[model samples]
Target chain A: MITKNRKITFILSLISAIIGIMFAIQLKSNMNPVPNESRSIAELRSSLQKELEKHKGLLADISKYNLLFYQYESSLNEGDSVSVMKEELARAKRMAGMVGLEGEGTVVRIQDAVIPEPPPLSDLEEHSYIPNAVIDEDLRWLSNILFANGAKAISINGHRIIATTAIRNVGEDIQIDTKTIRPPYEIKALGDPDVLISGLKLEGAEENLKLAGKQLIIEKHDKLLIPAYTDARVIRFMKPVKTKGES
Target chain B: MANRKFYLYLTLVTISTGFLIAASIESTKARNTERQNEKQFQQETQLNERILAEKKENHQLEVQLLELQRKVSQVEEALAQRQSEAAEILSELEAARMMAGVVPVSGPGVIVTMQDSEQAAASADVTKYIVHEQDVRLMVNELRAAGAEAISINGQRLVSNSEIRCVGPTIIVNGVKSAAPFVITAIGDPATMVGGLHLPGGVMNMLQDYVKIDIQEKEHVEIPAYVGDGKMDSSAS
Candidate 1:
C-alpha cells in the first residue's frame, strides 16, 4: 500500500509540472505582439503587389523627368526657350485641373430610392427609423472607385475634383468645393468605360447604394467632357521651396 | 485514517491540476485562432519586409525626380531672366505647378495627427473606434475650406488625381499603403484652420468619439511635391 501511494503521488507531481510548463508557454505567447493578426496572407500579397507596381511607375517617372530636364537645358542653349516654356506651362495647366478634358468614359447617376408608405400605427419604432438618402460619403467613394480604375478626370454635377476640392455634407445638402449640389447627382469620369464599369461592379457599387436607399445608374459615353475646376482660390499661404540660384 | 487523508490530498491535487490544464488550453486556443500556421506567419513577415524595402527605394527615386524637376525649373528661370516673354510664362508655370501640387511648398500652417482610439482594439465594434477614409477626407475638406493652400498626408502629396481609400486594414493614399496614426500637414492660416476645425458640429465634433486627433499650429510646414508623371491618359483639349 505504501509503495502504491508513493507511485500515485509521483505521477500526479509529474502531471502538475507538465501543466505548469504549458501554462508558462501560453502566457508568453499571449504577451508577444502580433501586428499582422488582422490581415490574411492573400491580403498581404495583394498589398505587396500594389507596392511593386507603384515602384515601377515611380521609376518610369524619374526617367521621364530626367529627359525633360535635358530637353529644357538644351533648349535654353539654342535660344528657343520661350516656346518650350509656353508648352510646359500648357502641360502644367492641364495637370492643375485648369483645362477641361474629353474622352470615352462612364457617367454614373445616383438618386434616392422610393420607399412605400407603411400602414398607419403598425409599429411606431419602425416608422421612426428613416433611411439615409444619398450623402457626401457615397459620392466620395464613387469618385474614388472611378479614379482607381484609371479615370483621368472626374466631376460631380459640374464641380471638377481637384487636389484642393472637397466633397462635404452641410446639414441637408451636399457640397462639392463649397457649392451645394442637389439630388440626382451626376458623376462624369474620363477614362475607359469598360474598366470603370468593371471597377464599380467589383466594388458592388450598385448593391451598396441600394442598401443605403439609393439607386445607381451607369452609362457609357463614347465622348464625354469633364469641366475644369471653377473655384480657383488665390493661393495666399504657400510659397515654393527655394532651390539653389533662385530669387 | 492516514490512508484516507492521503486520498483526500490526492483528489484535491488532481482537481486543481485539471483546472490549470483547462485554463491554459483555452488561452492557447484563442491565440491559435488569431494566428495562422508557422509557414503563413513566415511568409507574411517576408512580404512585409520586402514591401518596406520597396517603399524606401521609391522614396529615393522620388527625391531624384524632384532634383531633376528643380533643375529644369532653374533653367527656365534663367532663360526667363534674359527675355520678357519667357518671364511672363515662367511665373504662370510656377503658380500652376504649385496649384497642381507638382512643386513643394512651405509656410505657416497646421499639422493634424489622427490615431485610432485606445479602446478600438478592445471594442467589439472596432469600426466605430477606428479611423476611416471618410474621416480623413472630411478633415482635408475642412482644412481646404479654411483656406489651406497645400496639403500632404504621411509624406504623400495630394494631387488633383490623388485618391484616399482603404483596402482591408490599410489606408491607400496616392497608391501607397499606410497605417495609422496618420499625420496630415496643411499649409494655411493656422488660426483660421483651427477655428474651422473647432466649430460646433464640425469635423472635430463628429470624429471626437471615434478617433484621437491632435492639431498643432506651426510657423513652418514643408509639404513635398507630388512625384508622379501627372499625365492624363485621355486627351485634354
Candidate 2:
C-alpha cells in the first residue's frame, strides 16, 4: 500500500540505521586515540612510544617466570646459572638500549632551538673550510653510522625513530622529521654506545665533527623510556602492491 | 477456472522466493571471499617481511665477518705493505671495531660550514644572504660524489638509513634542527676527501658562488654521535 517514494525512503532509512549501529560498535572498541597510519619516526620521537610498550610487555611476560626463580636465587644460590642468565639478559637489554637496538636508548641531546647566534668576521678567514648542504650529508652519514653500530631505534630530538625519519636542511636550520632542533641536540640511541661510536669512527664520521668544532659524546646508559605508540597500526592501506587475484 | 488462477499464484510466489534466496546467497559468498582474500594478503606480507629481515641480519653478520677476516689476513698484507703488523692490527681493529662499534677512532676528515642570512628587510645591515635547503642538499651530494665514506650534521649520524628533509626555511637532519652556522663533517682518506672537492663545479666552488660557505680539512677529526631514530622494521631490510 506504500507509494514508490515512500518505499524508497523506508529502505534508505533502514540502511542508514544499520550503518550507524556498525559505526557505534566500532567506536566502542577504541576509546580516546583516533587511529591514523603510524610512520616509524613519530613513535621514535616520544620517550614512551609503542616500542617501549612492547618491551614492557616482554618484560612482564618474562617476569612471571623470573619471579619463580628469584625465590630460588636467595642465600645459598647467589650465583646460580638461572640468575647468571638473568643478569646476562639484563646486560644485553641495557646494551641494546644504549645503542638503540632493543629497548629505547637514553636521550643524548644534540641541539635545541634557542634564538640565533651572531657570526664573527674572523671566522671567515681566507682558505677557511665551509660546507654546502647540510641535511643530505648529515643524514647519509648518520644512517651509515647507525647501521654500522647496530642501532635498532634512534631519535634525533623528540621525533620518534621510524623507518622514514629523514635528515635534511630545509632552509635556515637543519631539519629532522618536521621539527627544527638546534645544537647541541641530544641523540638518544637504544643500543650500545661503544659499538655505535666505533662504527661511526670506522666510517670516518667522527673525523668530520672534529674539524668542524662540534661536540660529540657517546654514553652508555641503562635504559631509555619511550612513550606508547598512538598511531594507526597499518600503513599505505589503499594501494595494494598485490593484485586482486593475488590478494 | 479456479484451478488455473491457483496455479498462477503459486508460480509468482515461487519466483519471488527463488530471487530472494539467490540474492542472499550471492551476498554471503562475496563476504566470505573478501575475508579470505584479506587473510591471504596478510599472511603473504608477513612472510615476505620475515624473509627480508633475515636477509638483513645475515648481511650484517657477513660484513662483520669480512672485516674480521681482513684483520686476520693483515698478517700477510702488512708484510707486503711494509707496515708494522702491530700498527696494522691497530688500524684494522680500529676499522672493524667501528662496525662492531667497540671504540672511537680518530681520523682525517673534512668540515663544511654554512650560514643562513635572512633577506634584509628595511633596516638591517647585511653581509650576504640566508642559507637555503638546496645549498645543504648540494653540499651533501657533493660530499657523497667526492667519495666521503661518512658524514654527520648537528650530531645526527648518517647511515645507509638516514633521511634529511627541508621544512620552510630550516633544515632537518634526522629530525634535528641545525641552523647556521651549519657544520657538516665527512670522514674519509684526508687527501682524497679534500681533493675530491677541487674538481670543477663541485661543492667548494659552488659554495664560493653561493653563500661562500667554508670548507676545512683536518688531519685528525672526530664526528659526533648520531641522534636519529633507528627503528628497524621487518620490511625495511
C-alpha RMSD over true interface residues, each candidate: 5.6, 20.2
lDDT (10s digit) by residue, model 2, range A1-247: 4487456555554555455445444454444343433334332233223224333333442343344344334425323433433433333222222223335334443322232564565865743655432344564456545644566566666444442234555566766545576655566665556677676667665556545544355566766643321222221111111111110
Model 2, CA-based lDDT: 0.48
Worst 10 residues of 2 chain B by lDDT: B228-237
* TM accuracy, model 2: 0.31
Evaluated on chain B only, candidate 1 has a TM-score of 0.74
RMSD of 2: 23.8
The alpha-carbon interface RMSD of model 1 comes to 5.6
Name the lDDT value of residue B35 in candidate 1.
68
The residue-by-residue lDDT of candidate 2 on B1-237, one tens digit each, is 874565455545544454455555655875787686666556555555654565454445434333433333343234325534334443333333232222222356788887753342322654345566656656765665555545676655554344455555555665445455778776666567567667665666766643646778887555532321223322121
CAPRI-style quality class for the chain A–B interface of candidate 1:
acceptable
